[model samples]
Target: MADDFDVVVVGGGINGTGLARDLAGRGWRVLLAEREDLASHTSSASTKLVHGGLRYLETYEFSLVRKALQEREVLLRSAPHLIRPLRFVLPHAPHLRPAWMIRIGLFLYDHLARRELLPGSHGLRLAGGVYGAPLKPEFTRGFVYSDGWVDDARLVVLNALDAQARGAEVLTRCAVTQAQRGADDWQITLGNGRRLRSRALVNAAGPWAERFLRDHTQGANGRPLPARGLRLVKGSHIVVDQRFTHDHAYIFQNPDGRIIFAIPYQERFTLIGTTDVELPEHEEPPARAAIEAAEVDYLCEQASRYLARPVAPADVLWTYAGVRPLLDEGGSASSVTRDYLLEADAGSGEGGAPLLNVWGGKLTTYRKLAEDGATQLGELLGKAGQPWTAGTHLPGGDLGRHGVDMAAFTAELQARHAGRSPAVVARMAHAYGSATAGLLASPGREIAPGLFEAELQHLRDKEWACSAEDVLWRRSKLGLHYTPDERAAVAAWFDAR
Candidate 1:
């Protein structure tokens, strides 16, 4: 806490954690300060896919799509425990989008970037195909394409964990209340009344990037960097009982020209989502990223468009929303670019400290974005950055380039543990990977039935979890399955801790 570091990062979301990890791996002493638990906001509330933006092709964003497609493969190799291949079924909707257009889009997605791990896209006859069981009989044909699904929040936490292993300090629930840029360094004051100094600063505060610049980063005696602003678009998701038996996900195109995904989640429920509604102005962060009444109905109607069974609001078991901070390109929320921008100000610090601001990035391309950000920062520091994250494996992901067999690995772990439930074994294999051994050694690892006390304690003691919300919601998606008493019990345990 007394040292002036190489870089002080001001967010703990994907972008910030990615940058911190990259920088620390490059031998930079880094300190990351987060206002709350990591992935507490937009990073956790994602659609949970690591594919190229297939819909961005319709908006003519080829570069972003190609970059994302390339990064998708890198991440799948880097963290295969939490990231795996997922096939998506897109039912042919003649009225919404022409078949030829869809064909062209799929072609680009397959060939945009060099593919190594995933198979190419192809058409499928849905009459007896595995993907048609949940859809109506009218949907006689569809298309299958390759993509990847991820535990988004866990990815961020893993990056932070890797950074810590590389000698970076991560401080959660510690906000940067103010930053005074000096001619050679910056003095930052945190919410908990601690202070630290850094030779450079990186503002990666997602939706609060602009606000942090306007308020916290003033008094530096230099002009504010001209920020390419952000448009806050809120996206929401609802969980329901499993609608389909197949492991594949569905990409349903709405009559309104937007598309949403219904993916298999946690082996018990179908995860349907994502409405792009403009966010309302507020002075403080919204208490909840709750899905609105109309948004719920809208998603249900969209699902019913293809499903044989009518999905109503009452069918929804849980809902979540996240505010996407897109580049303010003056378009409808759905059309905004998923690309990112890194703005580096060399002389903004009164003491010649560099300040870099990050804006507008999607989860799929976070690695590349962090690599580029590191390049810019390295140049400012008179050091050239060599890309290293692509080949390196994150923690618990040592199962080789393509990853381990989930079934075989879980079976072996269950055999070792003897008394662990199959559900707990499988979940641990996916969530903890090779790190499961250390976690299983903790007391009450299974705090409640099916829920591991060790997993919760591991999260709180090591992963910066502070409350039941942090454990159940972001660290793991167990909220939908936990009963009221079970939830209260978890909360009580957190309180005692």
Candidate 2:
């Protein structure tokens, strides 16, 4: 039997959604299948930064850095609503990297990225500057630079939404059971006993990339590529009430050389993370366990080194962990490369089909990775469609009319929603961007009389949010602020919906 689609993409993470969007926009019939809800895996559990990996420069990954740096602007332009510029303050310690080396690295980082709207790197006298207000007196110097912050889970949904708008079929809770390359197309079997045929297949199963390939053979000639190994490295983060009153994020260096971030999250909380540890595959959500005593000690210890008031595990209101599906390079977890590898298996015969496998990537580089994957597919399919996503806007990203000035845009929103609290207005603006106006304009119906009723409805109606976990844990960080009763109420509302 022949296949059903021009392309079948397995995985609903950022890469898979991105590929589906890119292909479907080019007029190809595409189908994307995810075993769970969109971004129910590593995609939602990122460090939540659209960074250029300044640390990767130490490993001499110039090409990767350049690509990520360039994509930073592309993503910012594409989804100005879910992504925004964030300033970072990296404090200098006398015993750590020398001042000269840090300056040189910053210089390289600034030059690596094309400075269109973001400010360039500069020195900070931590004792007197805005960044030093929360720091310990011992920290007298720092480097301030720019990157972008993102709602990681929302990003995945936005890509999927864009793909669907362009006519792609996105099926969540639908798992691909098997795939075999055929003479004229690829035959794929779904867990629901539904069969699909496609001209091409993309194995973007993220952590399950190897497992998916093991089940799916390539080529009509009966040859299959060996499953590529992945190194599952778990990273965790903690959230606490606002530690400081600044908009800038902090990148704290630990005694062991690992770095952690204390970023401004939601307006009322600070986000801290993460610890790198190796865990066995097939582990059930490795991050749901409580922050280990050692990990908390390390975070508090490092945070205390730079802050005026010491932080404790008791201060942590919430925590999350994600496993980075790094390409196995046979090294310690910390030393593994954050770069991605793309492998295409094109069968030998004239009528053979093509299969693309994506292994290892970070959230920051997903857009570029998808563009490259589509280009590779274009080469195999002999169709050279002009790339359209680099400058295209993701849902709710139409910030061009607002001149991209969040402060001005937010001021306008506050005026429009005079009855809402400033906190709610700011949250909606940041979360929904230009679409906030539309969400607020909806019919008057209260799902729950809390921080936001219209906002919750918007998420449920448009974003496929089915539970309080999807809203609190993934859609936004409201779980940190809501009381137990409030949480239960929200849960009831989500269930009733």
Candidate 3:
């Protein structure tokens, strides 16, 4: 017998989890299926900025920039622990972009949306200044602007957690192998052998969205539905030993009209990235996008142009890549719009089931995308619910008595766990927010430095962590700090369990 659901969402990335949470909160019976762990793809491999895409202003993408800027404030308020304010320094490059042009762009960026939590942008004299210390001596002028940073993977998991708490079933490591549209519902088969019937279906498979439609879905009359066009662009980032001690990030302009970011990461490393290289449409992206040697050379060379200390490929500590599924607009990969389009189909009209296909979205706008997408799907399915996520806090986001002040909360947590390492305490406080009390209540055996057995058990029991990679890379970035032996120990712990 096929289990029943109001909606069956495919993929466990940001959009899928966010949509599931939104729909589930509206009283819909939701079943979210992920072929792998949550945010194991494009979502987690981001440059980790929650900004308004400062460069988009150059292309006259005012509407897109405004929408993302508005959402930026909403996200900052929603999850202060996982998302925090970050300042970026854009060194003056008169050859690349004139100062007047950059000034106008920053002006628009500052006033595009109502700013509350963050300050406005301003010009900076980079010579002999703290912000200029890391840059080459020739860089004398720059601009500083406000944006936000996020733990991208945790954001996805938190959405899934909230969905589950609201009566949705979250199934990771479960793929929707087959889905048939019936007159009133979707009959779906999973790789795990479970069968389900859902009134509506959502295709949010990220980079694999088009492929899923082509391979796994069929029309109500068993005919094939043509998939929408998507252009796959591969973006890669590299992590290196900390280059600067300050809390600011840098945005360097490249001769190719593309930009690169060198951001402070994990308290000890500098994260640099993101080269846009388009992949052939006929070829499928790898399960894990690996950084190409050319991409690495490009990033290191671009960043080195501004930094006082030169960066070589050998300096890279770790690297990651993600394929962005963009709307197939013919142009250079960097010029394509970062906006998204939601296409909904009501099969056979009348009592026919409806399907919503999500295409082309950025990390900064996932929440708004979910809100808008849910509103549309809800109306189509006659299950519309007033949007409530705008004013709500995500799970572990409510820092009671601290409001959006994460530092205060972390200090208090450190005091409470005086016997523990301050680093571990601070990480836990920021990671779990108010939930840190429960995470440290027992503080079971210390499996590795700053990693406790209790935390591992909590991940396995509540967060659906099944492997060391899930715990190290996605759940937390402790992988960067762990030695090879320590990582193996973590793997051994999971193996033993």
What is residue 230's positional error in candidate 2, in angstroms?
1.4
lDDT of 1 by residue, 435-457 (tens): 88676665374576677676776
| Candidate 2, 190-309: lDDT as tens digits | 878888988888999887787677656555656564677788887778777788998999998777777889999877888888888877765433424345677776777778788888
* Runs in model 1 lying further than 4 Å from the true structure: 222-226, 280-287, 348-351, 400-402, 441-445
**Arranged by TM-score, best first:** 3, 1, 2
Q: Estimate each model's TM-score.
A: 0.96, 0.93, 0.99
Q: What lDDT does model 1 reach?
A: 0.87
**In candidate 1, what residue range of length 10 has the lowest lDDT sum?**
280-289
Better model by lDDT, 2 or 3? 3
Compared with the true structure, what per-residue lDDT tens digits does model 3 show for residues 372-395?
889988988886899989889998
Regions of candidate 3 where Cα sits further than 4 Å from its true position: 348-351
* Candidate that beats the other on TM-score, 1 or 2, i.e. the better one: 1
Better-scoring candidate (TM-score), 1 or 3: 3
User: In terms of TM-score, which candidate is strongest?
Assistant: 3
Which candidate should be chosen as best, given lDDT against the real structure?
Answer: 3
Q: What lDDT does candidate 3 reach at residue 459?
A: 92
